[model samples]
Target: MSGRTRLRGRFQLFATLLVTLVQLPTVLWLCWLTRTPLPLAVAVPVSFPYLRQLQSPWHTTAPALSTYLALGWWAACAVFDVLMLPAALAVQAGLPRGVTWGVAGAIALVLGTDSVLGRPRLRKRVVHVEGLSPELDGYRIGQLSDVHCGPHAPESRVSSWVARLNALDLDLVTVTGDLITHGSSHVEAVARALGGLRAKDGAFACMGNHDYFTDGEHLVRELERQGVTVLRNRGVVVQRGGARLYVAGVDDTWTSRHDVARALAKRPEGVPTVLLAHDPDLFPEAQARSVELTLSGHTHGGQLGVPGVRRLSLARFVSRWTAGLYRQGRSWLYVNRGAGTTGPPARLGAPAELAVITLRRA
Candidate 1:
C-alpha cells in the first residue's frame, strides 16, 4: 500500500482507540457512581453509543439496554436523594440557622438560574438539494413536528422555531403533528408563534397522536386562525408560475384515522403530487396511490441514539422510513427528525431537525 493509504489506516485506528479510551473513564465512573453490578454496569456506556445510529441500523440492541439504564439510573437517583434528604435536613437543623439558610439560598439561586437559562437544546438540520427539476428546483419546504409544547418547552422556544422557519425563505411549510402536549394553551401559543411563518405556496398541517389526546378540534381551529390549513385526509392543488402541484395531508395513524384514498381523491390529474403524513407508515399507501413524494415527521429519529447501534429500536416496527430521505419503488419519502422534543427534555444522540425538501420532475 502507498504511504498515504497506510497513514490513513493508522489514523483511523488511532482515532478509534482514542475514542474508546476517552469513553472508558466515563463508563467506569457512571457505573461506580450508580453502584451497579457488572452486568448492569455495561449499560451506561453501551446505551449512549447505541442511540446515535437511528438513521442506519434497522434492528438494534440498544433499546433494551437503554430501558435498563434508564430504570437503573432513576432507581439509584431516587434512593440516593431520599437517603440524603434527612441527613441534609438534620445538618441544617444543627447548623447556625442564618448561615445554613444563606448557603442554601445561594445554591438554590445558582442551580435554579442555571436550569432556567440552560434550556434544552434543539437541533437544526438543513437538507441540501442536489438532484431536483429545474422547474421546481428551488422550491423549498420547511417541516416541523412533535413540538409537544408544554411546561418543558415554553413560548420562547416556539418563537425561536417560528423565526427559524421564517428565515428559511421556503416556498411552502408543513407541520407533521404533535404540536402540543396535554392542553390547548400551549397549542394556542404555538399557533401564534407559527403564524409568523411565511411561504409563497402557504403553510399546511396535519394532526398527530398527541393532538388527538389533547383538544384536536381546538388546536385545528387555532392553527386555522393562524393562517394554517389543516388538511385531515384532504388535499389542494398549489400553482406556482403555471406549474401545478398537489399537496395532500392525512390524519394520524395511532388514531386509526388516516385515509390516503380520501386525501388522494382531490389531486389534479397528471400533476406531481406530494403527501404530508404524520407517520412514514403512510408511504406504502401513498406510493400505491401514485404520490411522487411524501413528507412525514412522527419519529424523533429515536431522539436518543446509540452511536454504532440504531436509534429508537421501536421505530423500525412502526415505520420503514424512520428518518431522512427514502424511496419506495417510484415514490420518495422524506421523514424529518422533528423540530421539538417529546417525553424527556434531554436529547442525547438524535437532534431535532428542519427538513428542507426540493421536488423535481424525475
Candidate 2:
C-alpha cells in the first residue's frame, strides 16, 4: 500500500480504538448501575454496526433495519458517555452517585433532544461592504455547507433543504463543500437534491475534505451534470445590472489543493470579490488578498455547544472560525453552521444552518 493509504488506515484504527476506550468506562458504569454483564455490554457497543459494516458492504439506497438500530444505539451510548464521564469523575471525588447521575442525566436529556431532533433554520444576516457597487447592493445569497448526505442526512432531508433555499428566491446559492459523507454511493442523490436549488445567478460550490474522501473528482463531475458549478481554484464573474461581482473558489485545504492566489488569478481589477472556500481557516489568505467577502462552512458551528456561549462549543477545540460573521479591515468572513451532522449525527446549541446573507453597500 502507498504511504498515504497506510497512514490513513492507521489513523482510522487509532480513532476507532480511542472511541472504544472512551466508551469502556461508561459501559462498565452502566453495567454496574444496571447489574448487567460487563462483557456483553462492552461487546454490544464495540461491535454490531461497525462489525456489520465491515462484514457486509453498506446498501446505501436502503440501509438494513438492524444497522439502523445499531447506529442509533451506538450514537446514544457515545453521547451518554460524553455526558456522564465528568459525572463519573465527580462521583469518584466523593459526590453522591444519585445526585450526580440526576444532574448529568437531566443535562443529557435536554442536550440530546436538541441534538437528535433539531433542524437547521434560515438565519438572516446583513453585511455592509465598504465599496460594494449599487447594482450588486442588496444581493441575496444562500449558503449551504457540510451537508453530509448519507445515512445521517437522507436525500429527503437534502431535498427539503433545497426547497427551502429555492423558496427564498435568492440571487445566488453557494455550497461550501462536504456534500456527502460515509461514501460515494449517495453522491448522485445529493447532486440531484442540490440541482433543485433555484437562484437568479445560479448555484456554485467548492470541495471539502470529505468530498476528497469519497472521490472528489467524481463528485465534481456529478455536481456539474446536475447544473451546479464546482469551482476548483477558479473564479467566475457574475454581472448584475451594471456591476460585476467576482466569485472565486479554491480546493479544500485538507487535501493540500487550496491555492488562494491561483483561485483569484486574472480577476477583474476593480470589481469586489467574494471567495467560496470550504475551510474558514482560509479567511486570512483571502482577507490578505483583499477579498471583500469569504464564505465558508467546515466547522459545523462547533456542532455541540451551549445555547448562549459560543466558546463552549465542541468545535472550539479545533477551529477558531466556529460560526457566524467575522471581519478584519474590509474583509468579511461568514461561516455557516452546516446543513447536516457528521460523525455523531447530532446537534445541540449549534443547530444546522442555512445562511441567508444580504450584501449591502456601506
List the candidates' TM-scores in order: 0.65, 0.75
Write one digit per residue (lDDT tens) for candidate 2, span 80-157.
677776887999999998998987766655555556666787899998888789888899999999999988788999
Task: Supply the TM-score for candidate 1.
Answer: 0.65
The deviation in Å at residue 278 for candidate 2 is 0.6
Winning model by TM-score: 2
- lDDT assessment of candidate 2: 0.81
Candidate 2 regions with alpha-carbon error over 4 angstroms: 1-111
Residue 77 in model 2: lDDT:
54
